[model samples]
Target: MGYIILSIPVFFLLIGAELLWSAWTHRKVYTFPDLIANIGCGIGSQVVGAFTKAAIFGVYLWTYDHLRVFTLPANVLIWVITFLLVDLGYYWFHRLSHEVNFLWAAHIVHHQSEEYNLSVALRQSWWQGLFSFWFYLPIAVLGVHPVVILTVGALNTLYQFWIHTRAIGRMGWLEHVFNTPSHHRVHHGSDPKYLDRNHAGSLIIWDKLFGTFQPEEEEPVYGITTPLRSWDPVWANFHYWADLVALARRCTALGDKVRVFLKPPGWRPADLGGRERPKEHDRTNYLKYSTDAGANARRYVLVQFFLLLAVTSLFLFKQDSLPIWGAWVLAGIIVLWVMGLGLVLEGRRGALTLEAVRVLLFTGAGIAVWMSVLGWSWWCAVIIFLGAASMIHLTALSGEGEVAGQ
Candidate 1:
């Protein structure tokens, strides 16, 4: 997670380059709402990961402490072997995420984006970091040092970031060994042939060896089987789980209820319609989900979202310094701010109300800080001023937003 945080700047730079290429070529690879929502999902995931990551890593550390068969030296060759093992662990965790229903519920957010770009790499699941460490415990148990496990794991993550783009074509020979952009594009595809192929972090050999590899035959249609049709990051995280729970409730048999989570997604009960074969979805004339939000609403969303990103970054950097409860509180605020931004992007009617509530929270936090100091704090004063400005902008643009929604 620290590695990912440090690389956020590079991610945006690459994303910006992709945008420029799109504009220069008129390829229509990005939409404003989709870009915001993708980054929003990433931000929310990082913020959530901060609260739970230390304990999860502690489990790996505990396994290393207690279960090693032989003490392994952290030599150069050992580093290489550990890197391979960590990536292999990631591959299984990723493949299983797509296969099992419950895991998919945690992972499906990353694939919800209809557009594939560098930004898509950052569109992670908030809870996925929780489940992946279990898969890495085996490496820890094999006498691999915890430091090696973590460093290589972070490297594997960083390596995959550049693969989430259409800006680059096939890397010829490299495509055969490493997971290149072409391989990853197929993984993101919703086309029947590409549904579950190419589940690798950095190496493509795992997919080839396991018979899950699919070369790019045609331009692939990206996103999940069913379109999310939403910009709400909060909904992006939990919608699949909600869908699974709803399906389970509809199942009369107890076994079917359990299977709803264990089985592959779209695996309905016999009475509910059994497994859904992936139908052939063509790339021709496919339209991604979007909204016709007014200019004021769009600008407000854009500005506020950047502000949210700043605060989220600060929270991630200082989470360990603050009390656990304080960290959680800060995370909740950031998450709500992200949700509100998403709602505003979608031109939802009640978004302004949500924004108003968020503004009040911001104001309250600033007040708390101000009172604690018994005087002015520059940052607190800025927060109050920003909250007032946000409300004014919302007031000024309410009519335009309603018009756009209509």
Candidate 2:
């Protein structure tokens, strides 16, 4: 219920606004394929995880009906301790996801993109829920209420959002202990030495203690060793799985088969057999250069962000009965989906048509909000109708997001 209520329109609204603002800003180019694939994967994985969490919690509640485990203290100290421990649990799950092959398969999606943006945070793996939730079972077994776990998880996620940007540099001593943008950036790098390093989610201590730590030595190269190479969301989500499965089948020995899939990014089946393996070119500096398609896409994302803020505030003012807080929450989701669409269609010429439709719909919605605030009758209805029409048109144009003059 929380996922549906919080995710649906709210998610779309924030992401939509972000994309509009991103396009308008013209700072960097973003890819529609990257945007779309990332958002699709994010939503799919999150929704699936949400459902699994709820079902498991329900089962726990039924089994332990008499357990009175909501022992949250009245003091602020207890709350702080709980929050810190939740971060520790997340760190374990996150670090393990990097060390274990099956876990890495689910996590690699987030590191697949070359660009770093808020949307990149949404580029989650579809299979991550298959195992990540298991790490949290101990909390339930210890009788922490499911509601508390979910709330802390959401807070942990929200806290991570600010760390996903190049816009924020490192903070002196804080950089050494916290997972700041600089350290996190190194974690996402594809540079040979930087691979499988710095796997902190909310805290940096896990990486430090477990010796999975590597500081940002070189300016990192982002994305996977075997790039997904396509904007298709389905492909981005499953390509690694396919590669691992295929490599497993081709292995002559059972141990070699399992080892090949579980080894580091550049490892091959022949490595264990002392046979020659195919050489790969160094992509050390690939992400440094700028692409025209990338520039346009980033511009689109900037435009979406500002537009979301502007229009959402406008809507809140017009609908005086709606809470002010809800407007900001709505704005975040709109920005996310917009970035998602932009990434999914990157390098395709069809993005222009979608942009046109998005602009028209938003313009109409803005006007309607203004009209309602000015006491215009039936204006809100017109806005709704036009907004729906615009979205439908945009949906139709989405297929052509990679093509020009469509």
**Which has the greatest lDDT?**
1
| lDDT (CA) per prediction | 0.86, 0.61
Clashing pairs in model 1, backbone N/Cα/C closer than 3 A = none
lDDT (tens digit, per residue) of candidate 2 on 343-362: 42454454455456555645
Total backbone collisions for each predicted model: 0, 74
Per-residue CA lDDT of model 1 for 1-406, tens digit only, reads 4787898888888888898999999998888888888888989888887778778878888898989888899999989999999989999999999999999999999999988888888888999988888898888889999888988998899999999888899898999899999999999999989999999999999998898999998888899999999999999999998999999999999999999999988799889888889888755668888787777788888889888877777777766666655666677788888899888888887888888898888678646634443456677778888889988988878755453453
Candidate 2 versus truth, CA RMSD in Å, comes to 8.5
What's model 1's TM-score? 0.96
TM-scores, one per candidate = 0.96, 0.64
